[model samples]
Target: MQINKDRDWEALYLANDTFWDHGEASPGLVDYL
Candidate 1:
């Protein structure tokens, strides 16, 4: 999959901000767990 290389996307993964608790868990896999 293609990922965004934009500053905002970088910030999220870098812990500058959160998009789903900063990678706590992917909701899609939560059901299997």
Candidate 2:
């Protein structure tokens, strides 16, 4: 996983500006977990 320190992107995501949030665990991640 990559981490971004850009404040603009961080703020946007924190403020719900992102378009994708499945509200569930990803299948691949769930499998790994």
Candidate 3:
């Protein structure tokens, strides 16, 4: 359960970061890949 919670948080953070990478803050969308 603890590991799962950590994974969830990591996923959320990753998603948020990915979103930001392509969000209005960027001049244009950039694929992390």
After best superposition, candidate 1 residue 15: deviation in angstroms? 7.8
- Arrange candidates by TM-score, descending: 2, 3, 1
lDDT of each: 0.62, 0.71, 0.49
The model with the greater TM-score, 1 or 2, is 2
The superposed Cα distance between candidate 3 and the true structure at residue 18, in angstroms, equals 11
Estimated TM-score per prediction?
Answer: 0.27, 0.40, 0.28
Q: Which one wins by lDDT: 1 or 2?
A: 2
lDDT of 3 by residue, 1-33 (tens): 234443566666666844334444443434432
lDDT of 2: 0.71
Which residue pairs in candidate 1 collide?
none
Deviation in angstroms for 30 in model 2? 0.2
Error of 2 at 16 (Å): 5.8
Better of 1 and 3 by lDDT: 1
Report how far off residue 12 is in candidate 1 (Å): 11
**Tens digit of per-residue lDDT, candidate 1, span 1-33:** 345665577666586565446446776788789
Where is model 1 more than 4 Å wrong at Cα?
A: 1-21
